[model samples]
Target: MQRLFNDCIYRIKALGPEDSTKLFLSRAFGSTNGSCPMELEDAMKKVLKKCGGLPLAIVSIGSLLASYNSPESKHMWERVFKSIGSEMESHPTLEGMRQIVIISYDHLPHHLKACMMYLSIFPEDYVIVKERLLMRWIAEGLVAEKRGLTSMEVAEAYFNELVSRSMIDRAADIVNYYDGREETCRVHDMMLEVMVAKSLEANFISLIGGQYEVMPYDRVRRLSIHGGVEASKQSSFKKTAAGRGRRKNINAMNVEHVRSLSVFELEGHKLLNQLGEFTLLRVLDLEDCKVIGKKHMAHVCRMYLLRFLNLRGTTITVLPRELGDLEHLQALDVRLTFLEGLPETVTALENLECLQYSNKKDYISDGPSKTA
Candidate 1:
């Protein structure tokens, strides 16, 4: 792989400052008509110098500048140049790149902002499976139902828009799955840092990690355990209630406010039972968790508000019949588990949109009779 990367580098030619500047301006303003605008020439030169002919830097900066959409005006271009002056002058590091990327995020349509911010739930460099992410989005009610289009289709369009804008990239290793051609997306690390910051600010997704204290605003709406690290994140959260000189009442933490929770490789049975308190929960994803038995997931069915439930790659051999109690459930993923058969009540999920199990086969039903 290293040799291939090195060989690929050897085959490429570096873009000169002139071409680099032209590319950035053209991408930003849509078209420069084969010439740079005299009114904005000085500001463009400054931006190009900071970008240093680096493709990623250029794209990031171009996206920021494009937000202005009036590159023909001297003041508009100068304002953008001034906004990035501090970071650009400092150095071409990830922090500098982050400033540029953030501008693009801020300019996204209001509806897409939450969708983009949700990407922070996954750890850095995490390969996000397309079908799983979209299904999760649909379950969260992030994609608004539109006329003549299913929420799944709208979610796919959102994913593609992010890809087109270079916010996320398609993962190289593709796996064939039941949904579609196996594809995944990944966000850059620098941008991931900005996303984490934004998510925390909006209180969109509360991320628990090492030595963190629960503030008044910490009441989780959507929670992601193990932000990047695996074992440490869980342990940190577990100790949060005990560590700080803060209140010890677990009830004070308001677990009920959490609408979505994703845990990876969970080995604690205690935590699994605690999920029962989150009655308002909509999405509970325990993929790859090491839950001991069906008892661990007993509370899940009682979550009447639940729209999505994922128990993939767990040790469970049987699903509780109470799962039918999730009347509002839309997506249920029990893939890669030892469970042999689904409960009869599973057909009771009239609103269920996607059901993924062990085999690479899709089971669609209009009602129980059609399935029969």
Candidate 2:
């Protein structure tokens, strides 16, 4: 344990005020094309003074300034300066930095808040794929569907918005998908911490890792299970003929309130049976999981409230014909699975807009034709 502790320790110091200011300006107003605007220089100075050389605080303030584009009025910057100073004076600690970040979060438009908080579901330093992330957002009903815009298009705009605000960033190595858009991104560690804090405060998600079990104040609305060697050893799975089977006591908590569930890289058969206890689930993601079979699809078909179901990268070969019972389903992803073909009942899903399968061409079926 002492060796492990020693290995984890790293000695470093915080940036000085001058360096902090440099980083702040570079992030907040850096233009590859030109210099900072002379008109906004004084306001930027005021912002730097209030930041107190804290990098996270500086970045948070810079993100706010970067998003502000209301003709660059002095009064506008004054409001920002006064707000940060007031919050800093009141808190006067690292908690003050937290307050600064929360202010930026609060200033976001209503629709973006959930999208930001959703970032908390992924593990720290997780490399997020834009395609997968957008699908998840659409599944959770976070993306607003418009007549002229596809949900993926709308989600891409939201991703760009968060990037512009410094909440998320592209991975170092860029890989463009078939559409020529970069598909991978990651959240900054500090911002990820803020997301986890806010997610817990709102009971919006319950995250289960290694041996840490977090008890929520009420029903957990969403659950994310991250499985690893340590997590597997720590889990209370019943021994089966195949191996140690994973199971969660969903009945002990407010199972009826769980709206979303994501399990990463675990065998899902035993755990999937627990869905009988969840009545309000709309999103069920078992991406990259192992050995999910046809019997599991039986329970899934009965989940009438389901709007998004993803079985990507699993061993499931066939989707049950009764899947049509999930009349509310909007997005179904079966890519990279063992499935031969979609059941004919899928044509019955009048509300489904996105159908991703293993075929060379992706299917974007508009809701059943009104003329037909």
Candidate 3:
């Protein structure tokens, strides 16, 4: 195998990288999708020279722009054409994720676009449990109900499409949580930023931080808000549902299963016990909620089912020692704090796998702390 690989490398050197790429594509997608794989190869070929030779770079950017069509979407295109600032390239040959996510957003069918944008509620790199995210999407009416398709099933279908398109990435873990588990998702920050911007432009009320009220509870999932926002970003954001155009009565929700709930802050209210109400919570993130205190967390920590927990920027340094009770904890994203270390009780969580160490770095470790 080594000899064969070496000989092939030698032959590829003779064939050159560009031709080699062509040959590889010719074999991979040949006769699969109507046109020859080179059809995409040729399209990418033009971008390759300009974008250097990074496939991801060219493809990410091209795919992002492939389906852009809207009065609002047109504004973004104008930004590109007007020589607007773009982060679509890392190296001369590398593709920028900003462009890729945006392009992916554009090409989505109207329904799919609504579903994808609804997912922007979570913070960047925040893993979303498939079931929980889908439920919210359904609550927001993003999924079109079909005969024989349960709401959960419909949600999974949407997720599969996004995965197939590479619009959203799947974790390396084989255990992808459908109804909520520690298997949360990690999405790019740029995608969320664009969604927030568009939401603002479209009168979609954003509920990040203590900025907005949970109004018009009816069909409130899509043009909705996240658990909370960052203190740094709070000043730039305001608490307003005006971004969301109309208003309707809060729909009677049965709140069946919940995967993740991130509460940042409660503004001047000074206190909130919202999390304790959640029983099936998988990922509970309250990184910098200025108001919440130990009193509020008395019952919050008892969620033995929790998998991911982020209390990074908050004043409370030491987590409730009871956090050890979570026998299912998998990933914990808490950094830049005064807390000493995890309680020995952490060993109870036999399923504990990835512990996210914050430095703006997303690493997936093996057991306790290995490396991605």
Candidate 4:
């Protein structure tokens, strides 16, 4: 592979001071050329110096400062400068860039912090759908209800803010030409690392797959399952004494308090069979898991506290008749699934606001629903 790809490979060099300044100013003040007011020039120089000529660090810190009103606010500039630890300058490595990203995360508003950390639930390089993420945020109560704006509108604003801050990257290949909005996004690997660290520190989420295979001994509040059945099985048990000891099962971990659960593996149907343990779950995202079928849907119907249920791209042909039991359900996404029609019991969900499906044939035509 190396011999075949040698001619195609190219290394991106770090930006020099002048180019770094231009990039920083463009993100911070929307300047066509790199220019700053005289009063804040010193602080800007110091901030840029800490960025170490890395474009990612420059843009992240620049966009973070942009949130504060007035570029002329030397106090705000100095405040941000102070928030970045002196250790970053001493290190001057990729670790320094990671610190810069963490600083930006630290500056996010409380509500956005929760939403941002929640992004850690997704696997690295995962293409996150905007509407789906917003629904999850709303379900988790991460987005506050504004006086005139719906929860979704509030969530949209949050997503836009995160994008503007360069905390999340828009999926360049996916766009809605009619609306001129990017439909998907992905977190930069570095940013995801910072989010994962923060999520682990706060115990805000527990992940099972990839690099996060060890389950925390504490109560699992929000769980995200990644990888396939084998990965799940591996994460569910731990071996001791040079792999000769009896396997210890993680089923003893308390799960009744888990409020949200997301499964990204195709064989997540096995996990769904245990849904009854998570009685207080508010969000259940099993998107693109094709192995899920009617049997799993039966368990899903029993999640009485569920507010958001995303079964998009599953193989389930029919929703259970008891779907209406989830009176608190706010969003139900069955798009790209084998389901021909929603159960009539869906009409009984009084709080249902967003019902997303792939085809008109899936709708009953008697209630308010949002189609994909």
Instruction: Identify the candidate with maximal TM-score.
Output: 4
Error of 1 at 312 (Å): 1.3
* Model 1 TM-score on a 0 to 1 scale: 0.77
Compared with the true structure, the alpha-carbon lDDT of candidate 1 equals 0.69
TM-score of every prediction relative to native: 0.77, 0.77, 0.45, 0.84
- Candidate number that wins on TM-score, 2 or 4: 4
Model 4, span 26-82: residue lDDT tens: 998888475687887899999987766778888998898886636558898898888
Where does model 3 exceed 4 Å of error?
1-41, 54-56, 59-100, 172-182, 205-207, 210-262, 265-372
Worst lDDT run of 10 residues, candidate 2, spans: 363-372
Off by over 4 Å in 2: 1-7, 10-23, 30-39, 50-56, 69-72, 82-97, 145-147, 172-182, 229-249, 267-270, 359-372
290-322, model 1: which lDDT tens digit per residue?
764755668776889999888876667888888
Query: In model 2, what is the error at residue 279, expressed in angstroms?
Result: 3.0
The global C-alpha lDDT for each of the candidates, from Candidate 1 onward, is: 0.69, 0.70, 0.48, 0.77
Model 4 regions more than 4 Å off = 1-12, 69-72, 85-91, 173-182, 229-250, 359-372
**Candidate 1 vs candidate 4: which has greater lDDT?**
4
lDDT of 2 by residue, 1-372 (tens): 011232584322456766876777667667423345677777777777776666667777787777563445667677878887554533345556667777778778878889999988877667776777887788888999889998889998998888877778777544324223435888876577788889888888887643334455267889887546454554255223123322443334566778898876463345566767767889898876675776677878888999889887667878999998899998898876777799999999998988888832343432321110
Return model 2's CA RMSD, one decimal.
7.5
Tens-place lDDT digits, model 3, residues 98-203: 4545655766788887776665566555556554465456544567889987766887888877765556666643242221134345455456666766555554
Error of 3 at 352 (Å): 30
Window of ten residues with lowest summed lDDT in model 3: 242-251
